[model samples]
Target: MAGRRTERIDEWRERVDELCYDGERVEHRLDLECATVVVTTQRVLAFVPTTAGPAFRHVDRPNVGTVTLETSQRLAVLCAGIIAAFAGVATLEMATSITVSSAVPSVDLEGIAPLPGSNLLVGFVETVLAAIETGLLLLQWSVLLAGVAALVAAIGLITYYIRSRTRLLVVRVSGDDDLVVPVSGVDLEDELVVDLEAAIRPAPESTPALEAEDGRRTSSRNWTEIDHEESG
Candidate 1:
């Protein structure tokens, strides 16, 4: 099973690599259950695996105007609904058990003495009532336990969902279009943003070099003009 999963991941990675430019190399790769994301020197590529085939989205670093991250609440909401349903069922079971137990008549076992056949009859009634009460108590407890289990599960689910849920990375493109990518980890998002910024922003040192070259060219032009005047 593990081998097969690894093979599938390799296939997805290959698909992502295919979408990159000729010389672009992947700097970071994040593999999600439903999708795979790769950050390259030139662009960010997201590949979603589906029943039909793999779907892909590419966001060029230079075209990304802004990136925004937001948390998703779908899993948390679903877990909350499950917890509420379990609690409701437990409450109903407890109320039903209480009403049923109260409706049954109680026997005065202590007040009755050894009255031959009458004692046997009273003993049987007491035994039957005890069994019924025991069953009701067991039923109530089972329901309560189920509710508690559901509550624990819901709490764990909420905690995990809050911590590990995919973050929405909205990339606003140059033409006002948006490219939404579901990123899993905070570190991955930070790296992606850093790469994007690096790609978009020009290097500060390049400006100084260009200015110096232009100054040298202007000086040479003046020197040439002075030589031409002397020759004339």
Candidate 2:
């Protein structure tokens, strides 16, 4: 049983090497005690390839990596809030100005129109009301434009948050979701495999293994063990 287990481990290691060199996504099934690796252009999700056909729910999910949901949420919320707040402020200012202008007194100009030298203040109220109307129309148009811009920005934020928060992931043997791995670091042709290999490799330990041997060569070597090892 031990030898069989060792053989299986060796086979898995070899497969891992192949996966590393080929730059393919590999699903290591700890539950089933074997691994299934496949190469496909489509991003991996729940299904994995098999000789018979694609296997659904055959492998255990990997939990190796972390997702950055907070950053995306923060950025989208910040952008949307700024746009909405600016639009609200502009709308409030326009409303206040319109209200203040409409409250002013309107002096009648038709009563004093007979005199020839009364032209200066003759239509002051009408002119003021006309100017206020024109200003209100312009302000309404500006508010409409700002509202539309804010709505579009809010929609963009919603879209971004939805995409960033949720994903269809396929867990690899290394306990990582292979689908969401960033491919920006590598060329398109080699990115898939390179990222898979990077995910599977174990972190370096405090003790270093010997160059030619499987055992660790400690910094302080025992002279007696060296002499006995030489004799043996």
Candidate 3:
């Protein structure tokens, strides 16, 4: 049983690695539940699990251009406020609807034909009551719809927070595509960036001496041409 469990765990890890990098051996790994970053010999891979599905991106060592970090506190607070306001309004409207529905008395206009002024008064009261009920019903529905919209917006904001609240590691690839990975904390961010930079920084070029030689040759040729023109 122990052997089987160990084998299963290994298989699961292998599956996850394959899903991200097609069997690349992971040299460094940071797991954040919703997001993960895996560094291999050849590339850095970021995986994000979203509502639609799991999204993954791989940045070749040579193609990594830059890394950045950011936060989203203001947007999160704004979304929370909107959600609370809509929820409060919805509750208030619902309570008002219930009270009005129960308190208002139903009137019957079927039987007695009364005095002329009495008839006008009765019709006016009926119209007024009906308008109030209709307005309350519409108001309740409108508030409910508003509450739903606010709830959706709040959920979206929360999702964004979950994906971005932590120090976000934003990797810019050579072709202008960016791969964002959320790290758990600032320490992790610093450590990961250091590791990535060390791994991906290109080796220093040895072409400076060649470039200087080429410049010297070009200058000598120009001087030779000028001397020949003067002689002619």
| TM-score for all models, in order of appearance | 0.47, 0.36, 0.37
Residues 33-77 of candidate 3 have per-residue lDDT tens digits of 446666676787766643133355677877877766655356756
How close to the true structure is residue 219 of candidate 3, measured as C-alpha lDDT? 100
Alpha-carbon deviation at 93 in model 1, angstroms: 13
Worst 10 residues of 1 by lDDT: 47-56
lDDT of each: 0.67, 0.46, 0.66
Model 1's alpha-carbon lDDT is: 0.67
Estimate the overall C-alpha local distance difference test score of candidate 3.
0.66
Decoy 3 TM-score against native: 0.37
lDDT of 2 by residue, 135-182 (tens): 777776777667667766766766766556522123343443233222
Alpha-carbon runs more than 4 Å astray in model 2: 1-27, 30-105, 123-125, 166-232
Q: What's the C-alpha lDDT at position 44 in model 2? A: 25
